[model samples]
Target: MAITMTKGQTGLTGNAAIAVAMKQINPDVCAAYPITPSTTVIEDFSSYVADGKVTTELITVESEHSAMSACIGASAAGARVMTATSAQGLALMWEMLYIASGMRLPIILTNVNRALSAPINIHCDHSDSMGARDSGWIQIYSETVQEGYDNLIQAVRIAEDERVLLPAMVCLDGFITSHAIENIALLEDEDVKKFVGEYRAQNSLLDTDKPSTYGAMTLPDVYINFKHQQSQAIARAKEVVIEVGKEFGKKFGRTYALFDAYRLEDAEAAIVILNSAAGTTKVAVDELRKQGKLVGALRPRLFRPFPFKEIADALSHVKAIAVLDRADSMSGFGGPVFNEVRSALYDADKRPKVMSRIYGLGGRDYKVKDALGVFNELQKVLETGKVETLQKYITI
Candidate 1:
């Protein structure tokens, strides 16, 4: 069956877009806890369940940890499961986050990006999502409300693929994008149903006739092999993300590769970013290019697999690249994107000299001018090989 697009449109927040997508997917079970920025998604889902729009088990747990635990059980029972959370809530679910993927459950989740607390701030940032970067799940960041809605649908297909049966997380900036209202063109129910069909469990523990043990604790000798298998599955998901994205575009007329390039074809410099900041960087890129400066922007749509090959190829012709990271590593030598970009181009015969600029931490505002400043600094780095490091928690 082929999915077809419709012209229906709605003014919706990123949170609401996610809820709408989840309702369309029609999961068998939804277990979630209420957390700021992400609360509206589950709230909308609960309303759907109450109004008879969706017939599913909606479990509202007292804490985020319990929410994920319940989802694991529901998924192990051969049911499609889903949930949403942010910041502290995500930190609470850390242990189960590992278990959900290790068990190979095709659970889909959304992490509305928010700042992690030392003093407790509740606004848009990447701290929450960055904290869970090492968890065994496919992670994709959306720069706009429409992308968030579309990615949630594609994430299921990527996670449930036979070759890559792991959980996936669709992340959006907490208040900046998640709460901001936008005109979003959503896929019709028929199109979504055709694109992401019924959930088929290949080796679920809940199968009665073919009973199998799950979450088994293994000895050291066998544990290495399990880790190796998990790594291979994640590595294979890179191709699945690209394929599913293409299929989604073919069905809905909206295309998003693992990394989207804006005017980067023959540009001399480019800014690499993820999430909502990409929107601002694009503006800077446009202005710079208009002034006879050959600048462009590279926005990473998928973060977990890192999209190293595409990133390297995209920046191969550029002279210098500036990686804007919203979160900091503290102990690491550079930001997450900076680390990945450097690693991706280190062995190339000809590659751009990259600089890491930390910005927009703790929900600080990042304007287009800030992006331009980074681009200017990148030009300076290319010309003279000298650039200053911006301290943490400062906007500019």
Candidate 2:
């Protein structure tokens, strides 16, 4: 379907863009608590609710856990629900995070990426979102404020699809993208409302004629099957994500993919990373291309289901590749993204010699030079046909 959006550019931070998206969608309920970086999302959204800008029910919850619990309840009761959190706030809602997805509530959450506490630091990192990677939620990472807003709009459709009624996380780097202002064009409210459409749940808990049960205890025999069903929902969601992305692009002129591939075709070496770092990597890629180098980058937008085959296919032709992780797995093997990328290429017909590089923990600066260094390392690995270290840290 073609959508006509009014063209108007505005400068907004990632948090403000998210709030703008929420105001456009005007979900039935928003249950959220305040946290650094992410706090602005709920704060601005609350102001919209107060000024009569939107008709959403703004639930000022006491804690992140309660916020998620309330979202699950509202979703179960057939209301379109949303919430936002970061770092420890997301960690606190871990248990309920699984419950929301396990119940197939189709709740949408905006997770501002932050480092999980040990030293109690509040900075941008992938630990929080990566930690919840296995919680049955579809994850979409954003590289800029524009993508953050675009992802949030598409997230609603992806989550509420009848074939894939699962929860989704629209994640953006804390402070970096969340607080940094950038120019972005917003779609008309009527067009956004028309594109998002009205939420139509298949089996709502509020339906009186056809009663249903949620969260019922299952025996050992059926538990595995339920888990498999949840797995299948996400598997189906991959296709829905692509379809929604295509429609969104056709309407908004911005195309999205499971992973954004930059100059990857016919490249002999590449670097794989995620989030805002991809923006920096692109600058490096462009510079290297001028020297007739076959260097490229692959930034994964969808992380949960992994898009194993698609990723393997994209990198199958490259001779060497570097996978950069913003957070460490500490599993002695490699970072989370590294492990997954390696596993995806394990059985490829023409697999690339892959290396892992961990960078940007606790908001460390990752510059274009750092990305160029990784590309240079990949070029070296390609020329030597030998892997020096399987995993190492990239110092900026």
Candidate 3:
């Protein structure tokens, strides 16, 4: 699908756009705690709360763990729940994250991507969300303020679907997209209300008439079986995400998919990336195409429950590829996205040569020049039919 654009409202920061989405959603409950880059999301929503603009019951908590805990409880009670956090805040909620997903809470969370601390950085990176990649939450990365807003709105339908009752994290790069003002258009309040509809959880804890239990301990005999079901549910979400995207487009005119591909078809070289960097890389791709180079870009929007086969097919024709990651894997091998993309191509009929590159750690600049350099390297790989270095750092 081509990149869909909707323009109307302008000069809204990513955080503010997300807040507007939340206000329009008017969920039953909101569990909030403050963290940089994402703090204003809550602050702006709180003003709406103060003015009685939304009927949501806002619960102020002490920590991110407590925040997620409250979301689990509210969701179990049949209330549509949501929250927001970043980096270390997400780390603190790690334990609770499992309980939310494992129990099928279908809560919506907006995680502003930030670098995890040891050397104390408060900037953009994928380490926070990457660490929880296996935590069973559906992950969607956004490339701009518009996507961040759009994704969160769609996430409500995706997570709440009966076939895929799992929590979802709509992640936007912290201090980058999160702080940058950009063009965006919001759907009408009534339209958003009609689209999401009213959340009717099948098994509400508050229904004393039909009593139910949550987070009950299971013995090893049946534990693996329960996990298998959870795994299958996430596996089914890939289709639901696409379905919702289409419906959203029919209504709002901006459709999304598993991943967004630009100038990739019939290209000789391509760059595989995620989130906001795709915008910069696309500029590089346009420049190279003008120079008579066959190059392209593919940005994976959905991260968890990765579309391995779909991605493999999309990239089958390329002669060589460069997969860029915002965070280092620290395994002395390559970044997380590189490993997964390489593995995906293992079964392809014509597997292209793929290499890994890490960049933009702690919010380092990834300009068009840096992307041009990567594309230049890909051109060399196409000429020699060899990848000199399997992995390296870029844009330092």
Candidate 4:
């Protein structure tokens, strides 16, 4: 891993950063449909293609499902492929998403996290991506514009790795990170090109010399086995993700981890979260620390391949823990992340009492006070040796 400093660092929105990353990686094909929050990624990248800025074969699909379908075809034909979508756009692609990963296509997707509709909102939430958590795609959440940019570049290498040839998504909070302007250090075009490297297909449909079948209907016996292999590949992706992130850091000077732990080492209580809200929680933690409170925060970057053991270890020392989720699982128990974290610590010898807090649905504002309130609840649980509510929603 060699670090390269580029002279082209500039201020960019997360969507612009995504487009810039795509231009540098220069995938063979990109297929997408227009959807809010994520639409800019497609719009910007399309302009690049229109201006002859990249050699990518851009396809403007009519719907998100078709966009993913086109990407799957291009990827199976041995082309590096990419796409972007949000909210119901992601919902429409649900069926094809399984096909992409089950066929082992290394397609990269930028999913701008947005609220699911019934009341119909075009705001930020984790509902879209969390619904696809079990879809067999590797998922990475971004906390800032810079992380959004860096993660997209790293996702290419991770998805295309021979040992982990599965589709991956780099997710950013919908209007928050995606549309917000922020300063970011960019890698020179040549550096990103060198970093991502040229993609080579191993079992491509185009390889007439060694022809193969894909997505073939299988009997129960064979279907289960194929699913087993997909499981193994995602399991292997955990290591590949770490290796790629480390290499990316060495080359680009921005280190990434499965999750970012803040002031957790000696803390007695902590809040676990993801995406932009983690930054607010950090501020709350800092304020609490000033008052000599042992408060900490954990923000998970990797959601799929859900680093269970590592998370359990990270929280093992705390007496009480609260997992804050932007989406509800509606399972009558807790949110998706809360369930996973609780399950992860079930077998630990000295497990902390964990509670779940759901907040910010449909782009509701979450401030430092909201985070501090969660911390205060955790402190109460610590003092009482019991959790009054296993799951609760944050108001305002």
TM-score of each: 0.95, 0.96, 0.97, 0.97
What is the C-alpha local distance difference test score of each model? 0.88, 0.93, 0.94, 0.93
* Clash count, one per candidate: 0, 0, 0, 0
Q: Model 3 over residues 16-120: C-alpha lDDT tens digits? A: 999999999999999989998799999999999999999999999999999999999999999999999999999999999999999988999999999999888
Choose the strongest candidate by lDDT: 3
- Lowest-scoring 10 consecutive residues by lDDT in candidate 3? 2-11
Error of 2 at 18 (Å): 0.4
Candidates 2 and 3, the one with greater lDDT: 3
- Model 4, residue 178: distance off in Å is 0.5
Candidate 2 accuracy as TM-score: 0.96
lDDT of 1 at 265: 93
Task: Write out the backbone clash pairs for model 3.
Answer: none
Cand. 1 Cα-lDDT = 0.88
Query: Clash pairs of candidate 1?
Result: none
Runs off by more than 4 Å, candidate 1? 1-7, 388-396
lDDT string, candidate 4, 1-396, tens digits: 754444655778899999999999889999999999898998999999999999999998788989999999999999999999999999999999999999999999999999999889999999999999999999999999999999999999999999999999999999999999887888888999999999989878888899988778899779999999999999999998899989988987888889999999999999999999999999999999999999999999999999999989998888899999999999878889999998999988998999999999999998999999998888898899999998889955
Residue ranges of candidate 3 with Cα displaced over 4 Å: 1-7
